[model samples]
Target: MSGSGAIVLNETVHQPTRLRIMSMLVSVDTTDPLAYGFLQNHLELTPGNLTTHLRKLEDAQYVAITKEFHGVKPRTWVQATAAGRHAFAEYLTNLERVLGVRARP
Candidate 1:
C-alpha cells in the first residue's frame, strides 16, 4: 500500500458497478423509479450482468428491487435504501478527503 491511508469502503457498496448504481440511485432519491431496463441501458450492461450487480446490492440490503406485472410482462424497479445512501455518502467523503490531502502534497 502507498503511504496514503487506505480508504476502506463498506463491502455492501464496494464493487465499481454497484457503487455506480448506488450513486445513481441516491441521485434520484426514490422520487423517480429506475426500471431494470433503464439501468441496463444506462450502464450498458447485459441483462444478466445487470441482474448480478442488482442481486448483490439487494442482498446487501443497500437496494430494494420490486417486481410487478405490467400487462403480461413483469417489470423490475430498483431504489436505494437509506443505508445505501449513507454508505455511498460516507465513501464520497472519504474519497474527497484522500484526494484533498494528496493534492496538497
Candidate 2:
C-alpha cells in the first residue's frame, strides 16, 4: 500500500503472460537460464507470441536474453535480472496487500 492508501501495481510485471514468465524464471537457479523452447512449450505460446513478450521484458531490463549456437542449432536462453527479481517480489507483496493476505517469509 502506498501513502495515499491506494494499491499500486507494476504494469510491466502485472501482465498475465509476463507474470507467468517472471514466476518461472525467478524459480530457476540464476546460473541456469531457461531455454526459449522450454518456456514456449511450457507456457503454450507460439514462437512469435513468446518473442514479443520476451522483447517487452528485455526492453524493461527485467530479463536478459542470450542467443548462441549449440553445434549447428541456435539456442536462446532467458534469465531474470536482479532488478527483475526485486520487482517481482515487490509486486507480489503489493498483490498480497490488496488481497488482505500476509506475505510469506
Best by lDDT: 2
lDDT by residue for model 2 (24-46), tens: 99999878799999999999999
Worst 10-residue lDDT window, candidate 2: 96-105
- Tens digits of per-residue lDDT for model 1, 18-39: 8878878998945566898988
Query: Highest TM-score among the candidates is held by which one?
Result: 2
Question: Which stretches of candidate 1 lie above 4 Å from their native place?
Answer: 1-6, 101-105
The global C-alpha lDDT for each of the candidates, from Candidate 1 onward, is 0.81, 0.94
**What RMSD, rounded to one decimal, does every model reach?**
4.2, 1.6
TM-score of each: 0.81, 0.92
